[model samples]
Target: MFNNSIPTFKFLSYRRLQAGSLCPMGCNEDEYLHHISNSCSKIKDVFGHLNNWGFAIISCHSFADRCSWLEKKSSFIINLFCSTIYLSWKNRCEMVFGKTGKSPLSITTEAIGIASSLVICNHQNSGQLVVNQQDLLYKSWHPPPPDWIKFNVDASLLCSYKGGVGGVCHDHRGRLLLAFGRSCVHWDIAHLELLAIKTINEVFKDWMLEYNGIIIEGDNINIIKLIHKKIKAGMEGMEYLSFTKNFNHVICNWVNRDSNKLADLCANYAILSSFD
Candidate 1:
C-alpha cells in the first residue's frame, strides 16, 4: 500500500481491466488506495473515532504522503494505523465482492479492540509489568474453581464475513474433555459470539448433567454481559441464554483474547476449512 501498488479500482481500470474508476464506496471519486484508506465519506467516522482515541490519522493525497506522515509517529501508532487501514480495505472488499455490509461503527470498534491487543502484547514482550487492570485481565487464562468445569468459547469472522464458532471444555484440572468447531452464517461478530455459547450449550448437553457447576469463558465482554443480564439480549440473544436452564450452576466470564488462543484456533480452522 505504501508503494501505491494495491489493486484499487482506479489502478485496475487504468491498466485496462474491466473495472470502473469510480469509488465502490459511492463517493463519486476515483477508487485508489489513499482515497479508500482515507478521505472516503463512508470511512470518515472510523478515522474520526481513531482520532478521538489519540491516534490521529491525517488525510493525504498519495500513498507516499501517507508513508511520510506515518514516519514521525511511534511504532505502536504506526502499527495501529496500518491495522486500521487493512481492516478498512478488507471491509470494503467484503461489501464489493461478498454479501456482507458492516457498519462503520462496528469497524471502528473492531479497530480499537485490535489496537488494545497490540498494546497489551507490546507491554508483555518488553518485559514490563502491565499495571493497568485491563492489561492484567488480558495477561493469562485462569483455571476454574475446584471440581468445576470450564468452557472457553470463541467465534472467528473472515474478511468475507463468513464465521465459525468453536469451544473447548476442560475440567478443574485443565484436562480437555470435549472440543468442537463448526461454520456458521453471520455478518456480525457479536451474534457469532453468542452463537458460540449456544453451540457449547448444545454440544455439552450431556456433560451439563454430569457437571453441576461450570464456567464459560469468552473474549467478547458485551456477550458476557448479555448473558449476565447486565445488558439487553433481544429475542435472538435470549435464545442463547437457554444454557442457564440446563446447568445447575453456570458462570459466563470474559477472558483475554490471548488466553483464548486455542478456542480461536478452533474457530479459525472451522471457517478456513469450509473454503477448502
Candidate 2:
C-alpha cells in the first residue's frame, strides 16, 4: 500500500478490470489509496472512533504523509494502522461484489480485534502474558458463517455461587445484534453455562424471523458436549426445540476461551456491575 500497489478502482480501470475510476464505495469520487486514508467518510469514522479508543491516531492527508506518519509510530500502532486500512479495503470489496458491507462501527471493531489478536500472538511468542490478557483477547471473537447468526455465551461464578451469565448475538459480518447479561444469586459454573445456552432463545426470540440459521458457541467443551448428547425432556427440551424449529440449521460448537472472550467480558461485567 505504501508503494501504491493496491489495485484501487483507478488502477483496475486502467488495467481494464473496471469500467471507470469512480469509487467502488459509491462516494462518487475516484478511488485511490489516498482517498481511503484521507477523504473516505467511512474509513474516517473508523479512525475517529479508534482515536477515542486511545490509539491517538493522527490524520494524514496523502499516502506519502501516511507513510511518514507510520514511520515514527511504535510497531503495535503501525500494525493497527495497516490492519485498519486492509479491513477498510476488504469491506469495499464486499460491497463491490454485492455482499452486505459492514458499517464503519463494525469495521472499527474488526480492526481492533485483528490488532489485538496479533498482539496476543506476539506476547505468546515472547513467553510472557500481559495482565488480564484473557480479557484483552475478547477482540479475537470470530464471526459465524455468512448465513448464520451466532450466539456466544459464558458464565462466571464466585466461590459463593454468585455470579453472572451473559451472551451476545452477532450476524455473519460480526455486527453485534443482541447482548444479554444477568446476575444470578446461586448457580454453579456448569449450570450457569447451561442456563446461558438455554436462554439464547429468550434473548433472540424477537429476531427469529429475521435470521435463518442459529449457531451457539461457548467455551465450555463439556457443557457443549452435554448439550449435544441430550436435552432434558421437559421445559428445557421444549425451549430448545422451539428455538431450533425456527431455524433451518441449529449448531452448537465449543470454542477456545480466547475466542470466547467477548462473552466472558460480558459475564464478568454483569457480576461487577451488579454491586453498583
Candidate 3:
C-alpha cells in the first residue's frame, strides 16, 4: 500500500540525480543534495521561504534516506516537499538551459498546483481525506499590493572590467514607467549596486513623483540587506552610506529574486545596451 501511495518518491529521485549530474550553476565538487537544497546561493531564493513555514529540512546522504523520511509524514507535508523538490529542479533547468529564469513565487505557485492535483488524486483513491484549508487557501491565491512599483536592476562589467548598470521601473499593472541603462567604471558587484542606487536617485530627482511607497528591487540580497539595516558590514554598507548621503527619501525593504523579476529583465537590457 505504501509503495503505491507516493509516486513522488520515484519522480523526485529521478529528477534529483539528473539535476545533480549536470548541476549548471557551477556547484563545486562538494555539492550534493544537502548543499544544493540547503546552502547553494543559486537555489536559496526558492528554498529559503520553507524555513519560515516551519518545515524541517533534513540532510540525507541518499535518495532512499530522503524518501524514507518523507513517506512517514502526513500527505500534506509529503506533498509539499515533493512539490518543492520538483519545482527547484524545474527552475534550475529554466535558468541554465533556457535562460528564462522565473521568480520563486511563480515557481512555488506552479509546484503547489502540480502537487495539489497529485494529492487530490491520491486522496480520492484512498477514500477522500479532508483537505487542509490553509494549504488550499495558500494555493488558491496570492495578494500583491494594488499600486506598488517594482524596479529591477542588473550590472555587467564591460571591456575594462568596468561595469554598467541597467534598471527598469514598473507599476503594479506591469506598465513600464522608466527604463535606463548606463555604463560605469565600477569594478565589483558592490560598486555596481551603488551605481544602481545612484541611478535610481537620479531618476527620482528628475521625476519628483509623489509616491506613497516605493520598492527598490534587486536580485542581490546582500545589497538589499545593506540598504535595510539587516546587516552591518559588507559591500552593502558602503553603498548604503553613499546612497544615504545623496538621497533623502526612504526606500522600502529589499525583496527576493522572485519578486525582483522586472529588475533582472532591466539588467539584461542594460547588458545588451552596452554592446550598442
Candidate 4:
C-alpha cells in the first residue's frame, strides 16, 4: 500500500517488524507511531505543555489510520499533527544518532516554528498570502503591490597576483543596498560565490522587511547549477548543498558576467579600497 517514492517508510516498517514486540521506548512495530507520539516518557514533559496551545498527540495503528485521522481534522489540527510528527521524528533521530537530548519546551518551540513556516509557505505557493481573516485585514490596511521586487547579487574573484572576493546586491531601481570585498588566502571562485550568498542572506535577515520574492543573480554558472541541481555523494557538493538548503526560500538565478557590471565594480572598489 506504500508508494515507491517513500522508501524510507518501507525501511522503517521492515526494521520495526524485525525488532518484534513494541515497547513505548523500545523496538516494536506496534509502537512505531504511538511510542514516538504519546507513549515516550522521555518527551512526555514537553507534550504536556502543548495541550494549552491546542496540540494533542493521538495514536494510530498504522500510517493509513493516521492519514484517515488527518483527513477528518481541520487545517489547523492537521498542521499541528504534522508539526508534532516532524519534531518527534527529529527528536528520535537526535536521541539515537545525534546524542543530543533537548528539553520538551525546546521541541515544542521548534514544532511551532516549523508549523508556522509550513503554513506560510503553503499559502505563498497557492497564491493566497493571508493565513486567516486577520491576515487579510492586516494586508488590506497596508497593501503591497502584486508585482515582486527583484534584487540581483554577484561576487567577483580577481586572480592575477592578489586574491580576493567581491560581492554586491542592488534593488530594482539600481540602488546599491550592500557591497563589500574580502581577501581570500586561496583564490577559489566557488568558495567566493558561496561566501557572497551567505553574506546576502545575512543582509536580508537584517533588513527586517517582508519581501514578496527575491532573485539572486550570480555569474558563476557552476555555483548556480550546484544550487539548482541535485548533488551526488561526497564532500565536494556538501557546502553548496547546505547553502542552498539554508536559503531555499529565496530564489536564485544565473546571469552573464558582463550583465553584472555594477555589482562587479562595487566588489572591485571594496577590495582596492581595503589596501589604501
Evaluated against the true structure, the overall lDDT of model 2 is: 0.74
Estimate the TM-score of every prediction: 0.49, 0.51, 0.38, 0.37
> Which has the greatest lDDT?
2
Say which prediction, candidate 1 or candidate 3, comes out ahead on TM-score. 1
Which parts of model 1 have CA positions greater than 4 angstroms off?
129-276
lDDT value for model 3: 0.53
Enumerate residue pairs that collide in model 3.
152-263, 153-263
**Candidate 4's TM-score:** 0.37
Model 2 segments more than 4 A misplaced? 128-276
Tens-digit lDDT string for candidate 1 (182-226): 897779999999888878756755645666678889999998887
Question: Once all C-alphas are superposed, what RMSD does model 1 give against the true structure?
Answer: 13.0
| Model 2 weakest lDDT span, ten residues long | 130-139
How much is the lDDT of residue 156 in candidate 1? Answer: 93
- Candidate 1 has a TM-score of 0.49
Clash count, one per candidate: 0, 0, 2, 1
Best by TM-score: 2
The models' CA-based lDDT, in order, is 0.71, 0.74, 0.53, 0.51
lDDT of 4 by residue, 194-226 (tens): 666555544444352444445666678888777
Tell me the tens digit of each residue's lDDT in model 3 across 147-244: 55555666666666666687666544443456566766655877787577668765653342444345666657677766666324433545433433
